[model samples]
Structures are given as C-alpha cells and as structure tokens.
Target: MRFRKFTSSFDTEDRLSITIDDIARPLSSIQSSFEGGKVPSEFVAPLTKFAERYGGGSFSSLFAEGKSARQKQKLVEEFGSVLYSMETEEVKNEETFLIWRDACRDIIDWGLKVDFMLDHLKQAARDFFGYMLRPSGSESSCREIIQMEEAISQLRKKLLHLEQKLGEAREDLHLRLGDDISSDSMSCILGSSWVPQSRASRGLY
Candidate 1:
C-alpha cells in the first residue's frame, strides 16, 4: 500500500487540538562526534552502552549535542528495522513493549516540560521527601514532612486527572484511525501466519 498522511481533529476540553506529525526528525547533529572520534559506528546496539563508554556517560548528554543527535537517529533507524523483523509473539507480550507504553507518560512529560507542571512538580517533591526523610529520627520533623506529604498528595491527584485526559486523547486517536474493520482485514493483516481460534477447529492451525 502507498503511504499517505493521516490527520485528525478533536475538540479537547482544553479547547486545543494538537496535531503530531508522523515524520521523525534526527535526534541531534552527528558531525562533531565524527570529527572528535567520540562516537563509534556500532549503530545497531542499545545506545546506553555507547553513551557510557564514549558520549559522556549519559544518554541525555549525548542528546544535548548536535552530532550525537544524528548518530542517535541512525541508531533508532537501525533499531526500528530490527523491531520490524520480530515475531508478534516475541513483542506483544514483552517487558520492553510494556515499558514503552509506560514511558509514553515520560515522553509526553518531556514534550510539555512546562513551569508549574504538576506531574513534574510531584516527581521533584517525592524525590526531595525521600532524600530528606532518610535520616535517623527524621520522624521528629513532622511539621515539614506533613507539608511535603500534602504536596505529594495533591500531585498524585493532579497526575490522575492528567492520566484520564491522556486516556481520552488516545481513545480519540484510536477512533479516528478508521472504523474498526472486520476479521477479514485482520486475517489479511496477519497473513496466513497463525490460525484464529475459530478456524483452528477446522485444522487450519
């Protein structure tokens, strides 16, 4: 099938309809790393290793550089090809798939990175509270701990609200993808690879 653009329109309660482009941009520039010999062409491995040994020990740091960004894009491209080759059985139930689903929140959080973002504030508050409350007899600091606990509670409420909003957005996107097709479309998409439960009784498996 020929590729084509897909777009959607939705009236969010916030009165904004956001359109995300399908085409991905290069992660960063890749020239300085090549010039400085700081990156290797081992483009198919997980980038965490490359960053640890060469690109300053942090994926975020590598992402901050233009040259490292290009390399990252290349790495992602290669990784995506590997993903396409995987059997559905291997990916559909994997921990990696679940992490990407969970990490969608972090991805969206980074996109907004706004001042007064409650989810971000909540993460900071929880981190601070954990670090501060670890001392012996820290329970004596009840007044301060109470305030932090209140802030964290409020943050949890806000995060739940935002999660509901994101869920609605995803539902809208799913609806817009197209009316749900019949099992024929599903069979065509899955090819003759696996027998459906309904057909397996007929020795199709």
Candidate 2:
C-alpha cells in the first residue's frame, strides 16, 4: 500500500507530499517539537496517544503485520476510533488532521485486504471439511469439525461487526468535517476509487 505524507501547511487544498520517514518521525521528536511550541499545543495529547499506541511506527510497518486477521481488524478499529475521537477544531490545523486522516485511510484499506484473506481462509476450511466426507466416522473428528464450524461462524460475525463499526466511524467523520469531506477524500482515506457504499448497500441504517 502507498502511504502519502502531508507537510506542515494549513491549506488543505495544496498537499505537499513528504517521505514516510519524515511523516513517521519518532514520538520523542514530535513531543520535543511540541514542547518547543513548534506545533500547536492542542495537538500534544492526540499525538502522544497515537505514538503510545503505535510506538511511532510507520504506516507500512503497522499494516505489514497482516499475518493475523484478528490483529489486523483490531488495529483498523483502533485507528478508526482514534480518528473519530479527534477534535473537529483541529481540522483548521490542516497538516495534523490530514496526516492522521491518511493514516486512518491506510488502516481501512489494509483491513479490507485482511477481510478478504480471512474470508478465503474460512471458505478453504469449509471446503476441506466438505471433502472429508465421513472422516473415518471417528467421534473426535466429528467434534473437531463441529468446533471448526463454530469458530468460522464466530469469525464471520466479528468481521460483520468490524464493518459496521468502520462504517459508523466514517459517518461520524463526515458529520464532524461537514462539506469539507468529499467522496474523493473518502476514497483516498479508504484506499478505494469508488465512493463509500450507501446505508442500504451496507445493510446499515
């Protein structure tokens, strides 16, 4: 996934792209800059929270740990919650919000990929069981198959919930940001060219 970093500018219309290294500078460096009053005082807390949660990791590093579907989903949900909790007033400080919004978008895009992976795994497991037929008629095999099915069911439910939460979080962001938030911006954040699906399409509302 490509990660775009925004430079320090208040004009949202003009984005100055920078390197990920520059964007994901150490938490200590950010705090030091904040203490020197280089950045707005209002940004200190949210930046600190983000650094603590992510260990000042780059977006690529964070999303690269997609080996575990559950971990990926949790990471995406946490990122969304962080974005949702950000102060709307900070939108005026275009650089901060844009950087964070881009991070959120990266997480959402990564989560979508993870969702596909999990769905594939689930289907593969089902196919394996279907091909097993009688499975030697062993009680233990039967129990294990039943357990696997139950686990898949639970995973499916969890993925559905994750989608719902992400949708709601996106809606909250739109409401807070107002007209400034556009389909292009959403697409950028979501890492998808298409606009967000309607409530009916998502089985929401």
Candidate 3:
C-alpha cells in the first residue's frame, strides 16, 4: 500500500539516496536543534503542551530528568535517530527515487491534512472553552459541540476547494508545457529556470 502511494508521487534522482545514516543524521540534527535554544519563543507553549500530553512529561520536567540541557538535546536527538532508523528499515528495499520522492510527498500531504484538521480542532477547542465559561451546563453546552462540527465541516470544504484548485493548476501547467514551454516535467516547468536559492523566490513548498 505504501509503495503504491509512493509510485504515484513522481520520479526523482534520489534513488541511491536511501541510506539509514543519510536520513537519520539529518533528522536527528533537526530535532536536536529544536531541543536546544534554537526553538522559537512562539513554539514554546504549544511544543511544551505537545511534549507533555504526548511525550510523557512537561518540557522542563523532561529536561530535568537528564540533568542538563545537553543531555536533554541528546535524548531528542537519539529519539529522532530511532524514528528515522525505523522509517528507513520499513522501506529498505525501495528500488527508485520515485519511491523516495513519493515518500516525501506523502509526508507533505499528511502534514497538510493534519494542518487542516488541527485548524478546525483548535477552533472547536476555543468554542468549547468559551462555552464552558458560562454558568449553564444544560443543552446549551451541546451547541458548542455543534458549532465545532460546523467549523470542521467548513474546514473540510475549504480543503477540498484548495485541492481542486491545485489539481486545476497542475493540469494547466501540463497543457502550457505542451504548448510553448519545453521542460522535462511539471516541477521544472512551473519552477522558473532562473529561480535562485532564497526564501523570497521559493514558492510555498
């Protein structure tokens, strides 16, 4: 099933790039950077909350267990290594860069899905919390849940709308490339050849 999904993403040049160390080291470094002072202040509360509810302890408490910041960073770094190792093992025999690219696309797709889901969930939570502020615990409380359901429904609708727009854009790119542009594929076709390496020119992806 995963392989099927991977094949559908796109062809790429990362076929020989599937080493455990290659994937694990970068991911571990990224995770470790976050655990260190690299984390932004805006992320502190939410990250701390996520770590506590899902990661067993408060951020401070978790750090406390290791005796030092370096130790805490090491723990998350190790965790990242373990996760990447598991990911690599799962697809150790992948035969193509399409598989690698597909895996990356799947991850990106899942992230977008989770982002949309979390938007609605956060809105629902706000509504629920607002309702709780009221003294009444009657049938009115149920209305909050209904409001949350409606918000989630709207979120799904917007997501579908965006997906349709993206599909149309891809189709347009295909048609345009066939007409005038002479590029290898949609990615290279849509991405201007002269685009430089900078945050300003790199499109949302």
Best-matching candidate per lDDT:
2
Q: Tell me model 1's lDDT, rounded to 2 decimals.
A: 0.40
Assess each prediction's global lDDT (C-alpha) against the native: 0.40, 0.48, 0.46
Worst 10-residue lDDT window, candidate 1: 1-10
Please provide, for model 2 over 1-205, each residue's C-alpha lDDT reduced to its tens digit, 9 standing for 90 to 100.
Answer: 0111222232234433642224432233332233123433344555455545554532234456444755554554445334333443222323444455444444556543222322332343344444444457586887888999999999999999999999999889788878788798777766843446545446343
Candidate 1 residue runs with Cα over 4 Å from true position: 1-140, 179-205
Clashing pairs in 1: 28-69, 28-70, 29-66, 29-67, 30-67
Q: Would you estimate the TM-scores of all the predictions?
A: 0.21, 0.25, 0.24
Per-residue CA lDDT of model 3 for 1-205, tens digit only, reads 4444433432333344453345532322222135454542333445554466654654444332325666555444433333344334333333323333334343334221122322333344344444545577656667787899999999999999999999998778777657655546555656655545556646667
Candidate 3 TM-score to native: 0.24
**Candidate 3: deviation at residue 124, Å?**
27
Cα-based lDDT at residue 179, candidate 2: 70
When sorted by lDDT, best at the front, the candidate numbers are 2, 3, 1
Q: Model 1 over residues 107-204: C-alpha lDDT tens digits?
A: 33333211222343344334444554467777668668899999999999999999999889756755765668565764575476555555555664
Which model scores highest in TM-score? 2
Instruction: Determine which window of 10 residues in candidate 3 has minimal summed lDDT.
Output: 110-119
